[model samples]
Target: MNDSQALGRISAVVSENDVVLFMKGTPQFPQCGFSAAIAKTLSQLGVPFTPVNVLDDHAVRQGIKDYSSWPTIPQLYVQGEFVGGCDIVHEMHQSGELAQLLRDKGLL
Candidate 1:
């Protein structure tokens, strides 16, 4: 499929699921440090999410960037909204906002 098509598929995955994390690797084997950090944060918050491994598909890897308008993997989407990456998630976690947000979305 094309880039937009690939991105549309990923976006549908995110939208259909309550908590979706498009990361560089799986939850058990995060490829990047940031990906691992985000995984840990999500775990710590007890937010159950489906992880999409970008490494599994090149189109997904590049398309996700275009999908979010953010040039990064390990992107977090809550209720279909692009929530940002590790740094932003970390900041939200530290400030006790992440949990609240998840709860608000009924994902926590």
Candidate 2:
């Protein structure tokens, strides 16, 4: 897909899923450390999420970074909002803020 198409697809995916994770691999088998970290955090919290493996599609990998303007992989979207990446997620998890945020969204 072209850049515009990729962006459209990303928008649809984010909007369709309550919790979307655009990562390097599936939650069951993350391709990178950063991806695994965020996946594990969500798993530990028992949050059901849709994991989109960016590695499977080059267009998506680059498109997502542009879409979020975050310049990183393993981006998390909660109820169609950009959450953050590994370090931010880990920090939030440690501070109990992630859980609170999930709860607030009625996702947990």
Candidate 3:
């Protein structure tokens, strides 16, 4: 698929799922440390998220970065808003902000 097509798919996934993670692999078995970290964070919070494995599709891997204007795997979205990548998520988790955000979004 072209960039636009890929973006469309990404967009659909984002909008359709209240919590969606565009990552390098499945949440249960992430390929990258960042992806693994984010997945673990969500799991710890008992948040249910739709995992979009970018490794399975080149278009999506590139398209996700373009779609969010954030160059990184393990991109997070809650209630259709771009949250952040691993480091940001880590900070939020440490600061207790991640749980708050998830609670505010009714996902936690």
Candidate 4:
């Protein structure tokens, strides 16, 4: 797919899923450390999320970066909102903020 198509696809995925993770690989087999960290955090929180494997699609990999303007993978979206990447996720997880957010969203 092209840029516009990729963007459209991403928007649909985020809107359709209550929780979304645009990462390098599936939750079962993350391709990178950062992706793994975020996936683990979400799993540990018992957050039911849709994992978008960017590695499977070139357009999606670049599309997600452009879509979020975050220049990173493992981007988290909760209730269609942009949550940050690995370090931010890790910090939040450690501080219990991640769990709190999930609970607030009825995802935990």
Candidate 5:
């Protein structure tokens, strides 16, 4: 897909899923440390999320970064909102804020 098409797809995916992870690979086979860390955190929290592997598609890999303007992989979206990457997620999980946020969204 082209850039515009990829962005459109990303938008659709984000809106359709309550929680989405735009990562480098599948959750079960994450290609990067950051991606694996976040995936593990979510799993431990029992949060059901959709994982989009950017590694399989160049346009999507680049498009997602542009869409979120975060310049990073493993971007998390909760209830259609950008929820930062690994370090931010790790901190939130440690502080109990991630669970709180999920609860607030009626996701947990």
Candidate 6:
């Protein structure tokens, strides 16, 4: 499918899932260190999430960068909204805001 169509699918995945993580690989085997780190952070927070493997889809891999304007993989979406990447997540975690955010979204 084209970029638009793939983005549409990704949008649906983000919208339908409460916590969606667009990462390099599956949650079990994140291809990038940043991806794995964020996965671990989310896990420690005890939040259930859906992981989208962008490595499997080139269109999506690029489309998401355009979509989020964040220029990175392993993007996080909570309650159908963009929540930034590893650095942001780590910052939030450090401030005790990540757990609060997850609790607010009822995902923890």
- Name the candidate that leads on TM-score: 5
TM-score: the better of candidates 1 and 4: 4
Q: What TM-score would candidate 5 get against the native?
A: 0.99
**Per-residue alpha-carbon lDDT of candidate 6 for residues 2-66, written as tens digits (9 for 90 to 100):** 99998898889988989989999888988999899888998887888899999998999999998
Off by over 4 Å in 5: none
Model 6 poorest 10 in a row by lDDT: 99-108
Models 1 onward score TM values of: 0.94, 0.97, 0.97, 0.96, 0.99, 0.95
What C-alpha lDDT, on a 0 to 100 scale, does residue 6 get in candidate 1? Answer: 94
TM-score of 6: 0.95
Residue pairs with clashing backbones, model 4: none
Per-residue alpha-carbon lDDT of candidate 4 for residues 2-106, written as tens digits (9 for 90 to 100): 999999999999999999999988889889999999998888777888999998889999999999999988899999999899989899899999889988988
Models sorted by lDDT, best on top? 5, 2, 3, 4, 6, 1
Backbone clash total for model 2 is: 0
1 versus 3: better TM-score goes to: 3
- Clash totals, every prediction: 0, 0, 0, 0, 0, 0
lDDT agreement of model 2 with the native? 0.93
Assess the local accuracy of residue 56 in candidate 5 as a C-alpha lDDT between 0 and 100: 94
lDDT of 2 by residue, 1-108 (tens): 999999999999999999999999888888999999898889989999999999988999999999999999989999999999988989999999999999999999
Task: Compose the digit string of candidate 1's lDDT tens values, residues 1-108.
Answer: 778789788978987998889998898999999999999999988888889999999999999888888988789999888898999999999998999998887777
lDDT by candidate, in order shown: 0.89, 0.93, 0.92, 0.91, 0.96, 0.90
CA shift at 31, candidate 6, in angstroms?
A: 0.5
Candidate 3: RMSD to truth: 0.7
